[model samples]
Target: MDKITYDGIRNFIIENELTDSVAISLHPDSFDELVMDYLDINNNQIERPFEILGIEILQDSTGSVQKNKVNILNVV
Candidate 1:
């Protein structure tokens, strides 16, 4: 599957209000698995823009997760 784009996720978050009242993203370091873990749609829809970023998935030893830095700056 194609890696989820940053703009795609940001747009989804704004439109669906998924981030509303949600303090942190549930994203993990293994972002690929997160697609199925959080999204409720079928396989065909998994790659769509509606899926939110699971940023919090990358947790540290202290159980605190950092913000998503992968595509944040569009360095790639």
Candidate 2:
């Protein structure tokens, strides 16, 4: 996806308090379509504009997942 589209999806996830792992369920074709569909339906009601730079997987010393580290920035 393009930068704007990707950023918009990231912003949507943040706005709805969803995690990256959520994509597992809505994968491949449906995820992007869902985001675009939601944007179209809601007329892009993204209250907070933000850019997701990256998602860092934080694992413990034993290699178990501790939590996810989302690198993000507020967009103007």
Q: Rate residue 3 of model 1 by lDDT.
A: 38
Q: Please provide TM-scores, in order, for all candidate models, with all chains considered together.
A: 0.27, 0.28
Q: Best lDDT goes to which candidate?
A: 1
lDDT of 2 by residue, 18-66 (tens): 5444321223343345445546756885322211333211212332221
Candidate 2 steric clashes: 0
lDDT assessment of candidate 1: 0.39
Give the per-residue lDDT digits (tens) of candidate 1, residues 1-76: 1433445455555665553334233235535444554454454454433334532222123334443423221111
Minimum summed lDDT over a 10-residue window in model 1 is located at 67-76
Q: Which ten residues in a row have the lowest lDDT in candidate 2?
A: 50-59
